[model samples]
Target: MKLQLLSDLHLETEAFEPEPAPGADLLVLAGDIDATWQGLERFAGWPVPVLFVPGNHEFDGRAVEHVVPALRGLCTRLGIRLLHRESWLFDAADGQRVRFLGAVRWSDFDVFGARERERSMRAAGYFMRLMASTQHGQPFDADAVRREGLACRAWLEAALAEPAAGRWQQTVVVTHFAPSLKSADPRFGRQPGTASFCNADDDLIPHTDVWLHGHLHCRHDYLVARAGRKPTRVLSQARGLVDKGEAEGLDPGKLIEL
Candidate 1:
């Protein structure tokens, strides 16, 4: 099936213009879907099935009580499937099958960097608190960085091990973070790779396929070797609304028949 993948559309409701483009079957919004939940309505009204995941922007690192409910409502209204630490199998146009395992990966400093150790620690704590801040913390330590990794890893492993695994013509991994190590470009600037950004998890190595993510707006496209030891395409389409110049480098509103 023809699918359109986009991310980081820090939504501007007044000027939002996303055409489904003719022949597009499914739409995948990797993350940073919008600047706020207010944009959800318009996104939901799109005439197609959308699969989305939350990006760091979607989280205030406070409580999901705000975003989760709104997202669920939007999904219900728009017929979109929001996956997080979950998997979904989709049928493409050519009878091919694709599975999406979604997650907002934690920063992997071991590979990315140790520069923002203090900030990473704080952010990690905030994330953990947000995860567990609900209930009497019934879920217990929802904010733990280790737990987040485990959850995402568990879901991916299970999805890859499905009994019908070999039945899929090809698989696509939809995540909020980059999955390949090859995307690691430490050659860039002042303190290149100093930001502790772009996470790459060990769990990702095995399920390598197409990693559709949107965290780095400048770093952009990358391809890495994984699983079948083949090139796994990675795309991060996070240009903000004002990026008219950058838009020229992208082919939006087109269906990628993979």
Candidate 2:
């Protein structure tokens, strides 16, 4: 199936403009659809099926409960599925079976030997507290880092397990953040202390065919090998097909065949 991917669209009604490629079978909004409902309304008129996910900005510094339903309803009206730590299996128009796993995943680098265990632990603790604070209606806390990371791992385990029955399964993992430092922005300029793409390790499962992410605006194309077998394609459409120095808007007008 052909898919057009876009992400990190921090739209404020007036500034949001997406002119996606024409005639795409599917459009995937990787995350951060927008900080307010304005962005959702802007995309309401899109012609094809859309799959959207929540990003850090989508939360608008609020709890998930507060914003999810609104976005979900908007997506429902537009025939889009808002995936968050969720999975879906369906057949394409040509009868090709496709499975999608979406998560605002946490970086798992330390466990994967991609980063220092101490650093991973520190980030984990911070993520856990963040999640907790959001749940309790309290201000942001660094401790939620671990909670978010562990939750993402748990969600992915379940999401990836379902397609094991098929010999020729196509799995796409969509997230707001990249899984490793290999694809991180070069602005850090080789600093050891700089966090990787997702600030953690990424474990690409055997069935994964593509990994789509955003958050690092300056990054564009990347590839990674998982398990020394099938090649996994990693793509970010922060500015679509526009080159790094271009003055184009965030919504790049490219259509990707998935």
Candidate 3:
């Protein structure tokens, strides 16, 4: 099936006009479409099935515990599929079946080790503070964020281990956070504060045929090879404005076929 992947639209800053390619079978909103839930309404009338995973921005100024259920209800009402620690099976006209596992995978802060984590805490502590103060007006501790990331990792590991995982001809893993270091902008990899949040651990690399992720606000495509597994294709399409000049020329609306 032809899948149109989009992410980091940040519609509040950059409006999104849904002009899917001809014969586009499905639309995947990887994450960060907008900060407000209402932004999703813009895509309601699209002709194809829509699937989404939440981005970190979706939780901005809102409690994740509350926002998640609300987003699920909104998706149900709008006929959109919200994939959170879940899987969906789609069958193509030609009888090929593909499975999509979706999650808003958070950074485990293990990308660069303890020194980077300390640096991130020192440099980006404001972000953690904002989340703690505003999340449901209850303290959303840093430990909680780390726990959530670990939980997502555990869920993915279990999901891939399931016998059902073997049935699909291909498995596409969708996440808001980059799963591999290669997907992250190389310049940011060693930065003090931003480096930790740019990637997730590479444990999921072996199980994915195609990894769709956002949050970098930059587009990338590369093949990642893991021990005893074939190379996995990783793709990201983000339309948000980036301060880095390297991402200035990327076409955010690019359509990718899987």
Q: Name the best candidate (by lDDT).
A: 3
Query: For model 2, where is the 10-residue window of minimal lDDT?
Result: 239-248
What TM-score does each of the candidates earn? 0.74, 0.79, 0.89
Task: Tell me the deviation in Å of residue 248 in model 3.
Answer: 3.9
* The 10-residue segment with the lowest total lDDT in model 3: 131-140
**lDDT, candidate 1, at 212:** 76
Of 1 and 3, which scores higher on TM-score? Answer: 3
Using TM-score, give the best candidate's number: 3
Q: What lDDT tens digits, residue by residue, belong to model 2 across residues 1-258? A: 778888866674225477656767778888766666567665666777778877766665577556667777778987778888887775667666778888877444344354464564455454445434364565543334445656887887777766457743588888887666666666554343333235443565444788888866654666666666667787788642233442254446666666
Candidate 2 wrong stretches, greater than 4 Å: 106-133, 189-201, 226-229, 240-251
Q: What is the clash count for each candidate, in the order shown?
A: 4, 16, 0
List pairs with backbone clashes in candidate 1.
1-92, 1-93, 128-143, 129-143
**Which regions of candidate 1 fall more than 4 Å away from where they truly are?**
12-14, 113-147, 161-163, 180-196, 226-230, 241-248
Per-residue alpha-carbon lDDT of model 1 for 47-145, expressed as tens digits? 777888877566643354455567767777777788877778887666778776777664443344455545545544544454444323343232344
Give candidate 1's total backbone clashes.
4
Residue-by-residue lDDT tens digits, candidate 3, 85-159: 999998866577889999898766666777567565555556677544345456555555666777888999988
What's the true lDDT of residue 86 in model 3?
A: 94
